[model samples]
Every structure is written in C-alpha cells, then in structure tokens.
Target: MGKPTGFMDYSRQTAEAAAPRERIKNFNEFHIPLSKEEQQIQAARCMACGVPFCQSGMELMGMTSGCPLHNLVPEWNDLVYTGNWEQAYNRLAKTNNFPEFTSRVCPALCEAACTCGHYGDAVSVKENEHGIIENAYEQGFARPKPPKVRTGKKVAVIGSGPAGLAAADQLNKRGHQVTVYEREDRIGGLLMYGIPNMKLEKHVIDRKVNIMREEGVEFITGANVGKDVKTAKLLKEYDRIILACGAKNPRDIKAPGRDAKGIYFAVDFLSATTKSLLDSDLRDNKYISAKGKKVVIIGGGDTGNDCVGTSIRHGASSVTQLEMMPKAPDQRADNNPWPQWPKVCKTDYGQEEAIALFGHDPRMYQTTVKEFLKDKNGKLCGLITVKLENRQDEKTGRMVMAEAPGSEQKLEADLVLIAAGFLGTEKYVADAFGIALNERTNVKTEPESYETNVKHVFAAGDMRRGQSLVVWAIREGREVARAVDESLMGYTNLGA
Candidate 1:
C-alpha cells in the first residue's frame, strides 16, 4: 500500500458536477475531474484490505457485488499513489478493455463492496479508473499496437457494441484476421444511439474505433448481416462467427391508444435527437420535438431519467416519470448490509437537472399508466394512471403489484416516451442464424461457453445474458474471445 494510514488521514472527495441549471443548456458531460495531486490522494485511500471484496466480482443475494472484470483495484491504486501512472494504466488495461466507457457509465459495484464503505465513504474506484485511462490517452500510452505476426485464421464478429468491439479487439490481438459488422450506419450499437451525448459524447467512441481500425480490425457499418447481407454468406466465408448483437427489443406498454402518434420508444426518441444533433445541430426537425410540450415517460429507470434530461434540453413545458415499483429507500436497509450492492435511491444527472428546472422530483412511485388518451386526429394527448400496492401472490408466495381501488387519475401529456427495459434479443436475427433461444428469449448458449447449438457459432453479451451493463458486456466479449480461440487452435493463451 502506498500509504497505510491514508484512509484515516483523508476523507472521501468526489469529482465536482456542473450546476444543473447551467448544464442542461447543452449536451456535454458535466463532471469536473479532480486534479492530478487530488486524484493521487484519493487513490491513497485504498486500504489494501486483506480480503478485498472490491475485486471479487461475486454474486451475493442475487446482485453483483464488485467489478465484473475483476479489476486490479488495490494494485492500480498503489501505482497511482506512487506516481507510476504508466504502470497504473498497464494494470488497468490488463483486465478492463474499456475503462473510459465503464468509469463514465457503470453503476460502480466495486465501490459499493469496498470495506471502507461499510463504515464510511468508499474509495472513488470509478473516478480513479477514469483518471488512469484519460491520463494514458494524454500521454500517448493508448496508441495502437498491431500484432507482430498473423495466424491467417479469419474471424467475423456481428454487432459493433461494447461486447462485439471487445471480442474483435481480443481476437485481432491473437494474430487472427477479424472483421466487425454493424447494422447501424455507425459503429457502437447502443453507445452510439441509445445513450445520449450528454453522458458520453460520440467523439469518444469514434476515438477508440479509429485506434482499432489502425490496429487491423475491419469495421463495416450499415452491414445488417441477416437482412441485407445474407447469413449464409457469412457462414460460408468466415471460419468462426460471434453473435454479440444486443437485446434491443423494447418491452411495450399494453395500454389503450398505444398506436397513437406522438408516442415513441425511448431508444427511437434518443437516437433521433442525437442523429439530428450530429447531422445539423438540431436545425433540421428530423427528431420528435418536446419543446413546450407536456411529456410523460413510462418506467422510472436510467432510460427514463435520460428522457427527462433530454426533454429539459428540448425545452419541454413539463415532464413526469412513472414508476410501477415503490420508491427505494434513501439509505441502505438493515438487511442489505455492507458489501452488498445497496438498493438505495440514486439521483442521477438527469433527475438532478429535472429537479433544478421543475423545482421538484419528477418521479411518480407506485404508479403506472392505465390508458393512453388521444386526440381526434390520432395524436397522443394524455394518459390515465392508477396507483398500485404490493400484494403477495398465494401460489408463488412472491409480492406482485395490484391496482389500488379509487386511485385512478388523468394527466395531460403531449408526448409519451416508453422507457421500459428490454425483454430480450429480437427474433428475426436469431431466426436468421438458426440459433436456439432460451425461455427468456435471449440467445441460448452453454454456461461459461459462448458456443451455441450450431457448430462454429457463438453468442455473448446481451444476446446470451439479456440486458446488462457495459462492463458486463465487455467481460462477456473477452471471455467469448477466449472460448473462440481455444476452439479454433485446440488451446488458448488468452486470458478470460
């Protein structure tokens, strides 16, 4: 450990955020990073616990407890404290394929499991990771290093999301010829469109893609493999095919008037805005505008929060988010003790901006839309909502939501954005490849082995595991790459 007593000497300090009111005017990251010295001090706070749960990546009580990548937290923290930033970056890159993406967007499971956090604030693992990667980029430590020798084995990776990218990066490094095919016009499946530019600017994705291209990974955008490009052709040409296609089919509400205009899926709404912003700086009205319109967002999750923030930026007249579930506690409950991922209320950036602008939190807990109201011309006008109460099911013995009597209310809404979470992978792509799907609709594969029922066909990330975090997707990619490598050569030196 760099400083044995560093935790006792310094209290926890996090990065500063831009004022909500000021930050909502533009779509850019608002976090103000700590200076080099301050970041070093923060790293020194890592206690170097004898049993560091921060890197365990264990599943406890049905929730992940630490970094899924099993990042070398204490080792890198020591490196940062000793001013060995190059070594710190090396250690970080050893496990994590994309710290920039994870540090900016991950829920920070490692911090939640930190020993210090059991009694006090945990070390800023995410921020320190961000510092290391950004510093490495600035110092030219992130330069492309193509393989010295080519093994002449060709591989094809479908989907250009984090998982696909990670798999391609690994496979290419193993001296194999690799090509990545993306359905969208741009690379980065969800990162390019599903996420707003405010959280992660598009330029960051482009920077990494450029480096991968330089390192000999072929990327083909607008190449929808199963549709325009025939699946038979891919199977005929490539020695191995990895399906990293994400679960993007959004779960839709079954409320009346769902077919009305002025209602859209959250991904479509966000993607339209980002595309418009990039193409013409929003000068063209290609996106669904919420300007001066009452907006209602279904599903009070991260996507709904992003809708709230984006609506505010679009000059929405009013905004409200509906949550069917009860609000989480402000602090950890007794049962959810230390080292467990705390199920507590989180005020994300979008929620903060909404509160600042609207003078109140926009979430409506234990409420769901009963019916969508529409105007005569078939445009969405409002919705009827009803409160719900948790009741135990007699057969299942599990709590389920039931509507509370006499709790129905109507609210006006000019636009409705469905931010409900995804169900699983779309059927068309799975059907195209003749891949078997699980009961959950995700692509079925053997446990710990990414290979599907079909020979030489593999699945990973959301396609195999359903909707999950970017960090988890990266882990899936790395592991799947190892599986593919082992199958190809009968042995693999690649790390899982």
Candidate 2:
C-alpha cells in the first residue's frame, strides 16, 4: 500500500473551488484542483489499510458501502503515493472506464467507508481520484488503447448513459465491435443533460467520449429504438444487445393543482436547464428565468440540492426546499453504524450557498406540500403546506403520515420543481421489444447474468435495476459485458 506513516505525515487535504460568488455567475464546473505537487501529498494520505473496504461495494442498511466498480483503491492509492501515476492509471482502468465522470458526480461511498475515516474526516479519496484521472489525461496517457484483435462479434448497447458507455467500453476492449445507440441528440443520457453544468461540465463528458471513440467504440445519437429504429433489427444484426437506457419514469405529485404550468418535474427542469444552457445560456430577462421568482423545491435528495444550487445561480428571489421526512440527525443514529452509508445531515454546496446568501438554511423538514395555487393564466402562484405527524395505521399495520391539525401555511412560489425520484425505465421501448418486466417495471433479467427472456438480448444498469449512482451503472456495465462475452464466446475473462 502507501507509506506506513503517510496518513499521519500529511493531514487530509482536498481541492478547493472557485469562490461561490464568482463562479455562480456562470453555469460551469467550480471545483478547483490541487497542483501536481500538492496532489501527490494528498494522494499519500491513503493509509492503504490492510483489509481495504474501499472496493467492497456491499449493500447494508439499504445503502451501498464502497466503490461498486470494485476499483483497486488501495493499489491505485499506493501507486499515487509513490508518484507512479502512470501505473495508477493503468490499475484504475482495469475496472472503471470513466473515472473522470464518477470522480466528479459520485457521492463517494468509498470515502464513507475509508479506514482512515473511523474517527475524524476521511482521506480525500474522491479528490485524489479525480487528480489521478485528470493528470493521466493531461500527460497524454489517456490516448486510446484499442483492442489488439477484433473478435468479429457485434454488440449493440442501448442508451448512452454511464452504464451503457461502460459496457461498451469493456465489450470493445475485448475486441468486440460495439455500437452505442442513444435516443437523445447527444450520446450521454443524464450525464449530458439531467445534471447541471456547475456539478459536471459537458466538456468532461466530451473529453472521455473522445478517448472512447478513438478506442473503437461507435456512438450513434438521436436514434430511438422501437420508433425510428426497430428492436428486431438490432436483435438480428448484433450478436448481443444490452439495455442501459436508464430509469426515466419520474414519480409525480397527485395533490390538487398538479397541472399548474410553472410546476415541473425535477428531471424536466434539470434537463431543460442544461439543454438551454448548452443552447446558449438560459438566463437574462428573456430566458427560462427563475430570476426574481420564489422557487419551492420538493424532495431532499441530490437532485433537490442540484435544483437549489441552480436556482441560486439563477438569482431566485427566494428559495425553500421541503422534505416530508423528519430532519436526519447531525450524527449517525443508534441504528446506523460503521461501514455503512451514514444517514446523517450535512450541508452540501447548495445548502452552504443558501446559508451564505440568506441568513439560514432554506430547508423545512416534516412538511408536505398540500396543493399548488395558481393565477388566472394557469401559471403557478403559490403552495399550501401542512406539518405531518408520524402515525401507525391499525388496518395495514404500517406507519403513515397524518397532517397536524391547524398547522397549515401558505408560501409564495412562482416555480415548483418536484424531485421525488424515478420509478423505473419508461415502458415504451420495453413493451416494443416485448421484454418481460419485473413487478417494479424494471427490465426483467437475472441478477449477474443480465439476460432477459429474449435470447441474445441482455440488460444492465438503471434500466435493469433502478435509478442509482453512476458508479453502480459502471459496475453493471462491466458485469454485463462479461455476461454477454460469455454467451458469445462460451467463456469470458471479462471480470464481472
């Protein structure tokens, strides 16, 4: 691993960011990087603990615990600690295809499980990871290392999200001709649009895609299967097919005034915002202006945080985020323990900015939006909310919420973004292909095998599982590649 005393030698450090005030003026990535010299010191902080849990990727207490891609965290950390970044990059690429993407957007389950983090702060595993990948690219080590031999097998990867791209990367690296089909105009699904530029700039996606293209993976955008393209055609032409289309069916609010014009789904808002930003800049008095409007965001997940950050940059007159659940404890609760994703409350960048700008955090817990109020033109005007008390239902024997009487309140909101989360992949393509679906409506496929009921067809990632982090999608892609390779060659060395 790393130097035995390296963790003690260097106090944990991470890359800083552009001043919020300065960076908020534009929708671009804000996090700044440590210099190469500074980066080396940061990487050396890895304790390289004996039973490294960084790559365990276990699911405990309904949350994932480490890198799902099963990256050689300690190996790479040791390599970076010794200033041997070239070897570190090679080791990293053995599993992950797009470290640059995950390094930025991933919640960093690996850091939460870090051995050094049993007490105080965890080593900056995330930032150090970004450092290594970024350095590898800068040093020209990221050039395409295409497969030496083509196996003459063809694979079609549906969806251009992280999972699909990862599967395509692994399949192509095994010398299988891989063509990725995306329904959107761009190759990346959520990475290209669903996320805001400040969190992950599109240029970062373009950077890695360029390398993948040179590595012999083909990307075809704006081709929707079961519509303009036929699923049967792909099933006939390709030796194997993978569904990485993603879980896109957004959950909706069924309360009164749901049809208000200004009330939009979080995915729609985020995707539209990113698309508009890329189109030119969705600001100014003429754009989809959140400027000077009172915005209310529903849901308290990462998507909600993104909306909060984006709204702040748009100069919203005021912002309030609502969470139905009670506020999480500042420290891990009795039920939550070590080696688990802590269910604790900490201010993310958005909340931090809101606090810095306003006097306090713009979040309210144990409150639910009852209805949206609108004006004559049908544009949203405000919302009615009420406090709720946790209660147990005698019939169902399950806990539910009951509104606390006389605790209702009204809040002005011209824009309301619902970030409640997704259900599963939209059924359009699945039905068209006649693929079996699980009760949850995710594409039905055997775990690890990824094979659907249809022969020669497979599924992976969000489309097969459910909406999850980019790291999980990457892992699915890697696993499914091995599955498809095994089906084709009757054997596979592609690690699942």
Candidate 3:
C-alpha cells in the first residue's frame, strides 16, 4: 500500500457543486473541482481491507452493494496515494472503458460498499475516478491504439450507448472489424439524448466517439435496426451480431387527458430539447417551452430530477416533483448493515435548485397526479392531484396505493413530464432478430454466456438486463466480448 496509515491522516473531501441559485440559470456543469492536493488526500483514505468488498458488485437483499463494474477501488486508490496519475488512470480504465460517464452519473456502489463508510463517510471514489481520467487525458496518456492483427471478421453492435461502445472497443482491440449502429442522429443513444446535457456534457461523448473512430470502430447514426436498417441484412453481413440496444421504452402515465398537447414523456422532452439545441440553438427549437410556465413532474427519481433542472434552465415559472411512495428514512435502519448502501432521503442538485428558488424542496411525498386537464385547444392547462396512502395487500403481500379521501386538488401545469422509468427494450429489435426474451422483456441469455437463442448472436447491457447505470452496462459489455471471442475462436480470455 502507498501509505499504511493514510486513512487516519485524511478526512474525506470532495468537490462541492456551485450554489443552486447561480447554476440553475445555465446548463453548464456546476461542480467546483477539488484541487490536486485535496484529491490526493481523499485518495489516501482507501482502507486496504482484507476482502475489499467495494469492488465485489453483488446484488444483496435486492440492492446493489459493490461496484457493478468491479472497479479496482483499493488498487487505484493506492496508486493515487503514490502520485501515480498515469498508473491510476490505467487501473481505472482496466475495468471501466468510460470512467468519465459513470463518475458523473452512477450512484457509486463502490462508495456504498466502502468499509470506511461503516464508521464515517466513504472515500471520494467518484471524484478520484474523475480526477484520474481527466489527468490522463491532460497528460496524453489516453489514446486510440488500434490492434495490428486483423482476424478477417466483421461484427455489428446495435445501440451507441455505453454498453455498445464498451463492446465495440473490446472487439476492436481484439482485431475484429467492428461497427456500431445508433438509432439516434448522434452516436451516444442515452448519453447524448435521454440524459440532460448539464449532467454529462455532449462534448465528452463526442470526444470519445472521435477516439473510437480513430481506433477503427465505424459508427452509423440514424440507423434504427428494425425500422430504417434491415436487421436481416446485418445478420447476413457480419460474422457476429451484438445487441446492446438499451431499454428504450418509457413507462407512460395513463391518466385522463394524457393525450393532451403539453403532457409529455421525460425522454421525448429531453431528447427534443437536446436535439434542438444541437441542431442550432435553443431559440430555433420551440416545440415545448417551459419558459414562463408552471412545470409539474410526475416521478422523483434521477430522471424526474433531471427534468426539474432542465425545466428550470428553460425558465420555468415553477417546478414541483411528486413521489407516490413514502419518503425513505434519514438514516439506515437496523436491517441496513455495514457495507450496505443506506437508503435515505436527501436533496440532489435539482432539488437544491428548487429549494433555492422556491423556499423549500419541491418533492411532495405520497402525492400523485390524478388527471390532466386541458384547455379549449387541447393543450394541457392543469392537473388534478391527490394524496395517497400505502398499504400491503394481505393476499399477495404486495405494496399498493389508494387515494386518500378528499385529497384532490388542482394546480396549473403547462408541462407534465412522465419520468416513471423504462419498461425495458422495445420488442421490435429483439423480435427482428428472433431472440428469446425474459419475462421482463429484456434479451434472454444463459448464465455466463451472453449468446442469445440465435447462433453467433450475443446480448449485453440494458438490453440484456433492464434499465441500469453505465457501470453495469460496461461490465456486461466486457463479459459479452469474451463470450463472443470464444464463440468465434473456440477459446477466449476476456474477464468478467
């Protein structure tokens, strides 16, 4: 270890984002970066535990505990402690092909499983991770080193999201002719469109795509596998096909007047805003303007928070988010033990902005939108809201919500974003390839083998497993690559 007693000498430190009042007005990143010294000190807090469960990335009690990418947290922490910026980046990239994306948006299961978190705050893993990769880019350590040997094989990967990119990168490294097909206009599917630009700058994704191009990975945009592009043609042309297509279907809120003009899905709205901005500027795109309008969001997860932040930037008159379930406790309960992430309620960036502008956090617990009211021209005018009480069904032991008596109220709403989450990948893509689907509608693959029902066809990422963070997608990509390589050569060495 770089410093045996370093954990004692350093108290955890991290980047504090810009105050909500200042940052809400713009779409730029808000984090105030940690200085080199501060990052080094924070890196020193990595406790060299015997088991180091932080990188285990297992599903425990229905919650993810360790790093899903199985990042070498302690090894890289020790590297950072010894002032090895280049080495640290190497170690970081060994498991994760794109640390920059995950560092910003991932919930950080590594920190959740940190042993030090059992007593105090976990190590600043996300910050240290971002720092290492940024330093590597600055030092010219990260580059496109394409493989020299050509295996005379061609592979096609559907979807240009994180999983597809990771799989493309690995196969390209192993001397396979790789091509990625993205349904969107841009290369990154969710990263470029679904996620708001403030969280992950579009330029970051562009930079990586350019590097991958230099590495001999061909990217074809606006090529929807089943719609525009023929899936059967790709199957015939490529020696192997990989389905990294994400869970693209969004869950809709079935309420009265849901078909109104202003009520929209979070994905459609976010995508439209980003597409317009990328096409020219915000002024050119005027599909759904939140400017000078009351915005009501119907989900309280990260996507809902994103809608709040984005709407605030669009000059929303007011933003209110609603949660259908009861709020989590402020601290972990008896059932939540050490090395387990505490499920707690706290304000994220969007809520911070809402609180700063409107007097308090905008989230309303156990509240849900009952019905959408529309104007004479069919534009959404307002929403009827109702409070609900949660109860357990004795027969099925399932949690359910019932409308509380006389809890109905009306509020002006120009826009209502349905951020309830995704319902898994679209059926057409899987159906196009005639692959088997799990009960969840995700691509079905046998354990340890990413191969689908069709021969030489593999599935990975959110398409294989429902909606997930970038880290888990990357891990799935790498594992699937080894499986594909073995299927082709009859032997493989890729690690999970």
Using lDDT as the measure, the top candidate is 1
Model 1 spans with C-alpha error above 4 angstroms: none
The candidate, 1 or 3, that scores higher on lDDT is 1
Candidates 1 and 3 compared: the better one by TM-score is 1
TM-score per candidate: 0.99, 0.97, 0.97
Please report the TM-score between candidate 3 and the true structure: 0.97
* lDDT digits (tens) for residues 1-496 of candidate 2: 6778777888887778777667778887888888877877777778777787888999897888988888889888878878999999999888788989889999999999988887767877888789889999899888889899999999999999999999999999899999999998877899998888888899899888888999899999889998989988998899999989999998888889999988888888788788778776764233355788899999889999988888988899888999888889999877898789888996888887787777789899999888889999998999899998999988999999889899899999999989999999889889878889999989998765699998888999999989889998889989899999999999998876
State how far residue 385 of model 1 sits from its true place (Å).
0.2
Q: Spell out the clash pairs found in candidate 2.
A: none
- TM-score of decoy 2: 0.97
Q: Score residue 420 of candidate 3 by CA lDDT.
A: 96
Error of 1 at 34 (Å): 1.0
Tens digit of per-residue lDDT, candidate 1, span 51-147: 9899999999999999999999999999999999999999999998888889888889999999999998999999999999999999999999999
Better model by TM-score: candidate 1 vs candidate 2? 1
Q: Cα RMSDs of all predictions?
A: 0.9, 1.6, 1.5
